[model samples]
Target: MSERVIKPVGRGFLFLDSHPAGCARIVREMSGQVEQRTPERRTALVVGSSSGYGLATTIAGLARYGIDGVGVSFEKAPTARRTATAGWYRTAETAALAAELGRSWTFINADAFADTTKDEVLDLVAEQLGGIDHLIYSVAAPRRVDPRSGETYQSALKAIGGAHTTKSLAFDDGEPVLQEVGIDVATDDEIAQTVKVMGGEDWARWITALQERDLLKPGFNTVALTYIGSELTGPIYRRGSIGAAKADLEQTALTLAKDGVTAWTSVNGAAVTQASSAIPGIGLYVSLLHKVRGLETPVQQSIALWDQLTGEAPLDLDDDGRIRLDRWELTDDVQSAVRAQWESATQDNIAEVADTTWFLSEVRRLYGFDVAGVDYEAETEVDVAWPDH
Candidate 1:
C-alpha cells in the first residue's frame, strides 16, 4: 500500500480524490445516529446507491432497519497513480461497518444501466435475499447505454426554451463569486437523450425483471428520489431539459402503480451533491438557503425519510401525489429570502449574503475532505479496497 499527503485538487464542484479514513469515519457516524428497527429479516435494493441521497439512504436502511440489502453503483477504481472515486471508498467503508454489525449488505460495483448487472443482481435477489421490500431508485448518471440499442445517451444541463442567463456561485479560479452565467437551450435530441439517461425507463425494467422472477415481497413499495428547484432556477432546472427528465420519472411512478407495484416519487430537498454541483444556479441557491433557512444534510434527510417510511403516520403527499420532503426548503418565506440574495449578492458580498463557505465545505466533504479530526496534512493510505460480498 502507498501512502502520501493528499490535498484536495479540483476546480468548482468537481472532486478528484477521496480519503478512506474520513469516509469510514463519516459512515460510522451516520450509522451511530440511526437506531435499528426490529431485527426481523427484510431486504432492500438501492440503485445508484453509493453517493448523495442514495448512499445516505442505504446507510440508514442497513444500519437503522437492519435490512439485508444490495446497493448497486458504478464507481471507478483507482488507477496505478490516481485515486479511486469517492463513492468507491464510501462503499468499502459502508460494507465493513455492515459486516461488523452482523448485517448482510452487498455492494456491487457495476454499471447499473447495463443488462448484465441487472441479471446478476436479480439472480442474487431471487436466490438469496428472498424478496425486496423497498427499492429506492436514486441514480444520478451523466450518461447511460441503452441495454437494447447499446447506444450511449448523455443528459444535458441546460434550459429548454432559449438561452437563459442567471446569477450563480462560481468558486473555481479564486474566491467564491456570484456572477451572471448563460446556458443554451437543449435540442430535441438532447431532450430525448436526457430523459433516456435520467428518466425511469431503466427503473421500470428493474421492476419488471423482479416481478417476472417473483422477487417482490408482500406489501412491497418503491420510491424514486427526484427534485424540483425553486423559481430562481425554474427556467434552467424546473423547466429545462433536466426538468423534463424528472417529469418523466414522476410520471413513471403512476405507470408503475397501474401495474400493481406500489411505487411513488419522493421530491427531496436541495443539498450539496455532485449532481447538484453540476446543475446551474443550484449551488448558489443551496448556499443561500443555508444562509436564510437551515439546510438539511443528506444524512439527516435520509433519517427523516426512513422514519416516514417505517413510521405509522400516513405518507404526506401534495396534490400531484408525491411525497413532500422539500417542503421545509420551499416555504414561502425561505424562497423570498433566497430570491433577494440571488438578485443582490455579488462577488464582494457573496460571503456576507450566502453561506458559500459552508456550501464549499459540504462539497469538499463529499470527497472526504474538510472532515473534522482528519489530518489532511498527514499521509493517508490510497489503496483502500472495496469490500467484497
Candidate 2:
C-alpha cells in the first residue's frame, strides 16, 4: 500500500489534517475581541455559515456572545478516500466548541440560494428558536441558479471599462513567484450574469421569505459583507463586474431599510479566504497590505463588525449608511505605502517589498495547513461527525 499525496486542487489547496491548533488560535482571536455588551437574547440566522467570515461570525455568535441559532451552508462531508472541505471540518469543530459552551446550535448543509433551503431554515428557526433577530449574509459562490427561471449565471472577475493587467503571485514549492495576469474586459452579458450571481438578489429573497413567514423579530437586523479596495486595485475590483454586484447589494440594503429591517452593507478589510484567493491581483495586494498594516484575519474583522452591530453605542455610518471596516486598510498612509510597494514589486523584489511568506502561509492555512503544532505526518480521520443538534 502507498500513501496518498495531498496537493492543490483547482483554486483550493488541501492538506492531510484539520489543524486543531489553528482552529483554536482563530477561536481565541475571535472570542477575545468580542465586547461584553451584546443584544439580549440574541439569535441569528447565518447564511453561508461554514467558512471565511461566515464561519468566524458563527463562532463569535455562539462561543463569544453565547447566542443560540441555526447556520446554513453547502459544504460537503468527507469520505473514506478523501478529506472533507475545510468548511466541513471547521463547522464540525465549531459545533463541538458550541456544545462545550452549552450553547444550542444547528447546522443545515444546503444551497443557500435555493428557496427550499430558505424554507428549511425558517422551519428550523420556527421550531427551535422561535424567531431570529440577526441575519448575516456572507455567501461567496462562483455561480448561482435562478430558482424562478432556472437560468444559471456565473460570476466573472473582469474589469468593467477595459482589460486590466496586474502583477500576481503563484506558489511554486511554497515560494511566491511573481506573474503578470490580465483580466479581459467583461461583456455586457457577462456583467449582467455576474451581477445576477453575486448581487444582493439572494440576500433580498432570504429576508423577504423570513419576513413573509413572520419569522423576523422586532428590530431584526440583516447585514451583507462587501469589499472595496484602494485605488491601486480599483480597475479590477471596485470598478469591476463584482463591483457592480456590490453596488446592487448596497441598494438592496437601502430598500430593505425602508421596510424597517435595519439592513446594512459592511465594507470589510482584505484577508486570505477562499473567495479572495481567486481575485487576480488581490494576493499581492494583501501581502503588501499586510506589510503595511500587519495582517488581520477575517475572524478579527468579523468580531469587530459584530461589535459595531450589537454594541450599545449608536451604529456609526458613513454618508452611504455603510459600516466602513476597511478604514484601517484604506487610510491614506497605508495606501501610499502599498502603492509604493506595488510599483516596485516583481519576482526578484517581491520578497523585499512584500510579506510573501506570511501571505502564502495564510493561504495554506485556509485549507488547514502551515499551522503551528499540527502534525501533518500523522494519519487523520476523514469521517468526522456533524453535531446532531
Candidate 3:
C-alpha cells in the first residue's frame, strides 16, 4: 500500500533505481505490438525472461501464441526507499497480461544457470506443459557461479590479441562526450573466463537435461541469441572477448546438431539493451547506427523472429548455420554510412550526426525512465507482485 514519486536516479548508461509504472507502460506497449496470432497449444522455456530481447520475445510468445510455459530469471524484490529492477516490474506486468489473455505461465525468480533451476524447469515442463516445443536461451549476465565447480566466472569486454583503440563515449554530468577509449588485450585466462560465463556450455547442459527427462517435444528447437557485428564493431564485439564467447555459442549449436538436437545460434540485430551500455565502444557504434538508420528495437526484431520460426517463410540461415537477423543493421551501405558518422562525430556535433537523443532515452527506458504514458511527476505504487503470484 506504499507509494512513492520515482524519477530516474542515474544517467548515461548507469542506473540506480527503476520505476514500476514506467516499466509497466513499456510492457503494455510491447504487448500491443503482437500482430501475429499463433493459436496453437505450445510450451516454451525462456531462460532470461525479465529484460531486453529475452523480455521482448517472451511477451511475443504469450501474446502471439498464447503459450503455456515457464520463464526463469533472477530479479530482486523492492525495498523501503528503493525500487526493484525494471525487469522485476516487467515480469509482474507480463504475468498480469498473460493471465488477462488467458495464457498460463510460471515466472521463476531463480538463477537459470544453476543445475537445480534447470531441474525445476524440467519438472514444471513435464507436469504442467507435458513437453517443451521451443526453448529460448536468452540468458545474459556479467558473472556466473558454476553449478558443478562452485567457481565464479566473470565476462570481460576487452578485445583479443591486442588492445583496441576506438571512438568511445564518456558521460560528463549526464551528457555523453565522445573520446578515444583504449582497452588492453584480454589475457588467456581472461578470454577463457569470459567464454566460461557467456559461452554455450550451459546451453548444452540444458539440452542434455531436457533430453534425459524426455521433456523435449518431437520438434523441440532451441536458439541461443548471439551478435556478430560488422567490421566497425568487430574489434570490440564480433572479434572481441565477447565475440570469443559467441563463437563458442555457435559451435555449441553445431555440436548439438551432431547429437540429433535441433539448435541454432541466432545472430540478432542490436538495439538498446542495458547490457550493451557497459561494453566499450558499443555506445558510440549504436549511436552512429541509429543516426544512419532508425534502429529496429529488440521487440520488433523478436516479433519478426517468431514469424520466421513459425510462419510460412523458411528459417533463414547463413553458411555457418546461424539465423541471420542482422542483415539490415549489417548491410554494407548501412555500415558505410555509420562509419562516416563515426569518423566525423564530435561532442560539438554528436547529436547532429548520431542519435544521442535515442541512445539516452533508450538507456533510461531500460531502467523504467523515458517510458511513454507514465506519470513520473505523480506518486506510483512501488510494491508489485512477482509473475507467479
Q: How would you encode candidate 3's per-residue C-alpha lDDT over 91-198 as one tens digit per residue?
A: 999999888989889999988889999988888888888989888898889999999999999998888988889888666766778888887899989899999999
My TM-score estimates for the predictions, one after another, are: 0.97, 0.93, 0.97
Off by over 4 Å in 2: 1-39
lDDT tens digits, residue span 191-306, model 2: 99998988999999998899889998987899998889878778888899999999999999999999777899988888888788888888889989998888666766777777
RMSD of every candidate to native, in Å, equals 1.3, 2.6, 1.3
For residue 363, model 2's alpha carbon misses the true position, in angstroms, by 0.8
Would you list the C-alpha lDDT of every candidate in the order shown?
0.86, 0.80, 0.86
lDDT of 1 by residue, 1-389 (tens): 88987778876788677787787777877787787677677789999888999998999878877778899999988877678898998899899888887988888889998889999998878776888998999998999999899899999988997899988787855469777889998999999999999999999999988898899999888999999969998898889999999999999999999989888898999988889988778888888999998877677777777766665347888998898788889989999988998788878899999988898888888888888989988998888887776
On the 0 to 100 scale, the lDDT of residue 356 in model 2 is 88
Give lDDT: candidate 2, residue 360.
82
Give candidate 3's error at residue 80 in angstroms.
1.8
List the candidate 1 regions with Cα displacement exceeding 4 Å.
Answer: 172-174
How far does residue 37 in candidate 3 sit from its true spot (Å)?
1.9
Candidate 2's C-alpha lDDT?
0.80
